[model samples]
Target: MECCREPSCRKRGRWRWRWRRQSGSGVNAEEEHGIKKIILIGTPNVGKSMLFHRLTGIYATISNYPGTTVEVFRGRGSFENQLFEVIDTPGMYSLLPLTEEERVTRALLLAEHPEVLIHVIDARNLEKMLSLTLQLLEAELPVILVVNMMDEAETLGIDIDLAQLEKDLGIPVVATAASKGWGIELLRKRIAEYVRKHGVRKGVG
Candidate 1:
């Protein structure tokens, strides 16, 4: 009965030790402080709320359509033996800002200065959604663009080249169907790595 300050080596009833670092590589000083905060931002019905709930197990009044949640919700989650505060912001279309709720979302990003910004997006509408992704990149924020709702995209016969997208975007791009819990573990691991590292280098995914 031994315990360590890391993930349990018990996947699929087998013991497998996994060491997590601040970056994809090994070793970094940023791991000392742990993950202070992570903010989830996206447009309406992009699964930001769902992914937030899934990550933190905190309910934030989910609905079938948009304009349901007019406020932000914050919760806590633990990954890679590190604790993090997760914030769910109101839907926003772009960083340029327009609606009151959208402005509110932008305000949270500026105010909180989260360690990592998880941009959840609907994969079916990549062209439209990528606009905001571009904006986030322009701001020079540590952003991880999540191409969520992949299942819906598949149903519509919409195929996305994730590797190409990642290369083009110059950031980590994760394809997931948050509703079905696909690619979540990888997302978590990526987030943990970003937090542990000072920040991902520019001009590279």
Candidate 2:
């Protein structure tokens, strides 16, 4: 069996010591300890939520964006002994906000400054989604493109060259069928590897 290296699996006394130091005002525990943040952003009906559930499981904290009615989901996920705080933002077609949800999502992106910005796109609608991916890259955010719903795309005889896409985008790209849990493990491995190399963002306090 693989040995567990999670924070909770550490020595009790050491864990308590670390927890005490991480406890503070304003920031949450994850932020206090410098846990990396992963934000999922994409247009509606792109399997974004399903992908989020696949990464973080069913237990999630649903809360409205501060000072707005737009809801956001936050959950915890562990990959390769690294703990991450994953956030599922509202569907946004573009960085230029039109709807209130889009505005909130954009605001969250700026305020949170996540370490890894995951752009989940529908494999069947690759052309339509590439625009937003370009926008994200232009903004200089660390992004990972998730070509989700590959099964559907395959059904329609749509083929996506993930290797070529990754090469062109200059970032990690993954293919997944979120509903069927395909490529979820590879996604986790990629996330952990990305974080391990790039490290967490500074000034998160």
How large an RMSD does model 2 have? 7.8
lDDT of 1 by residue, 1-205 (tens): 2223344211112111111211332323244234367889999899998899778875232221123345657666777876776788888988978887887788778766677899999988889888888899999888999999999989999989999989988888998899999998999998888777765222200
lDDT of every model, 2 decimals = 0.73, 0.82
TM-score of each: 0.74, 0.84
lDDT of 2 by residue, 24-108 (tens): 4234544435567899999999988998899998867677766788898877788998878788989999999999999988987
Pairing residues by index, what is the TM-score of model 1?
Answer: 0.74
The deviation in Å at residue 172 for candidate 2 is: 0.4
Candidate 2 global TM-score:
0.84
Segments in model 2 whose C-alpha atoms lie over 4 Å from true places: 1-32
Q: Tell me, by TM-score, which candidate is best.
A: 2
Clash totals, every prediction: 1, 0
lDDT of 2 at 17: 41
